[model samples]
Target: MSVDAERPAPLMHAWRHPAPKGAAGRCIGARTDLPVDRRKAKRLAHRIRAIARREGLPRAVATSPLARCRDVGRWLRRFGFRHVVDAQLAELDFGRWDGRCWEAIDAAEIAAWSADLVGHAPGGGESVRVLLSRVRAVHARAPAALLVTHGGWLSAAVWLALGEAHAPTAATWPKAPGYGRRVILWRLQAPALHRPSDR
Candidate 1:
């Protein structure tokens, strides 16, 4: 085996940003950029700091540029952690469908996306394949990084970590981690295949 293959994967701890205001029942994506309550953001930041302190992880964090995720990173920065804002960590871009109520979108458009899960770009925005590629790049660049990101991004990371063989259909795609929830992506013994999955 190659040395790179023999090396263990780095650990990554990712937390979904706190739920944004006015996001309930809405198709909030990269373009939405909704705000999260400050208190909730601070609470999550404190939790991250406590975990880092307890586990001896680095005092550094990365977050999406969106307010919901960035707000948490800001709190971490105030607590003395090195904060990095990475656009790659942002949520899937939904294009025209962004920030609209679920019921407002056309059924046929939704079906079209579900039919091609991997290649179809909902709202004419980024495809699932593209999002997976971006997530993989982020992992490759900073395998052990701590992240504050969106649910869709977290789902992609989880899909990659699981070594799934096929692209996820609507039925197989794992649900998004709850807001403010932390998911630890352990380095797999073998490299994971990059495949498409939903946000």
Candidate 2:
């Protein structure tokens, strides 16, 4: 829903899943459902709840269907928060490369993807364009809400929040936040850039 210009802007909290147990240094995308680290998950959840209580509890909580994110979503329930599993929050489907160690992937294919990051569909999976479109659609529906999802999805959302003006250079692109870390984005004062039902 679009926020009113006269009313206060809603708060948004976007959190990345803690590292998956067996997928470190691998391309574990939407095609993988690796288990999460329970200790880290619980610790992050506690910190998230603490932040929500400080910033005003989120109006809603949402997560990707992947277990890594869903596990964290389950923890949010401990504080009496209900969450929705949204397919849009899923990581980019790595297609044939899913679950494969990054070092093992074809170097040429990786270079091609790097060359056309926004349009290339590496391993026959989705493109950056498609991912950002999905993220913007979700934001249009809930301008501000708590989100638990994958690193790629979080990166795309942050890119959109910054305005999709140009591709980031090595120095400009942000480092993905650490596992279980939280990042907040305050929607700008401009008119809602998307329609809730547009997509």
Candidate 3:
């Protein structure tokens, strides 16, 4: 067996941030910084804290810098948890398409992105390949960390965990986990092997 296949997978617990206000029907992305309801953020924070207590996980939580995700992390900080805001955890950047209503974008542009899902940068922003790389970096940094982030970010993590051999088509792409929902992930790929001299 290959070294990577024989290595144990890393573990991660991630939750999708609560739905943001004024985001319905809009193409919210890294550029769209909408606020989430404070109460909802608190509720999610409580859930995360309870999970950590039950699971004996660390008291640190990482979140995307977007307000929707950061708000929950703020509440966790109030509860004495160490909250970190990471830009890498942000959602896919949609460039000009971000914060715009979905109907406003050109259909051809969307189609082009769908055709080259991994390489094409939607709205002239980050591509799926880039997002996957960011997720992989985060996993490599803190594989067992608790995270609060966006649907796109979570989806990227899931794709990497599943081996990510080929680019996913629109039909094959994994759906994002529900808002305020938590998903546990295991990193299946092993860390890069280093030469003995390098080590």
Best by TM-score: 1
Candidate 2 TM-score, C-alpha based: 0.84
Ranking by TM-score: 1, 3, 2
How do the residues 5-76 of candidate 2 rate in per-residue lDDT, one tens digit apiece? 865555457788888888878998999899888887777677777777876767468999999888877888
Error of 1 at 10 (Å): 5.1
Angstrom error of the Cα, residue 165, model 2: value is: 2.0
lDDT computed for candidate 3: 0.84
lDDT of 3 at 31: 95
- Which wins on lDDT, candidate 1 or candidate 3? 1
Assess candidate 1 and give its TM-score to the true structure.
0.90
- What's the C-alpha lDDT at position 29 in model 1? 97
Minimum summed lDDT over a 10-residue window in model 1 is located at: 190-199
Error of 2 at 5 (Å): 14
Which ranges of candidate 2 are over 4 A from the true structure?
1-11, 167-172, 188-199
Better of 1 and 2 by lDDT: 1
lDDT string for model 3 (42-96, tens) is 9999999998897688999999999999999999999999999999999999999
lDDT per residue (tens digit) for residues 62-164 in model 1:
9999999999999999999999999999999999999999999999999999999889999999998898898888877886788899989988787777777
Please give the CA lDDT of all the candidate structures.
0.85, 0.75, 0.84
**What TM-score against the true fold does each predicted structure earn?**
0.90, 0.84, 0.89
Off by over 4 Å in 3: 1-10, 188-199
RMSD of each: 5.2, 6.1, 7.4
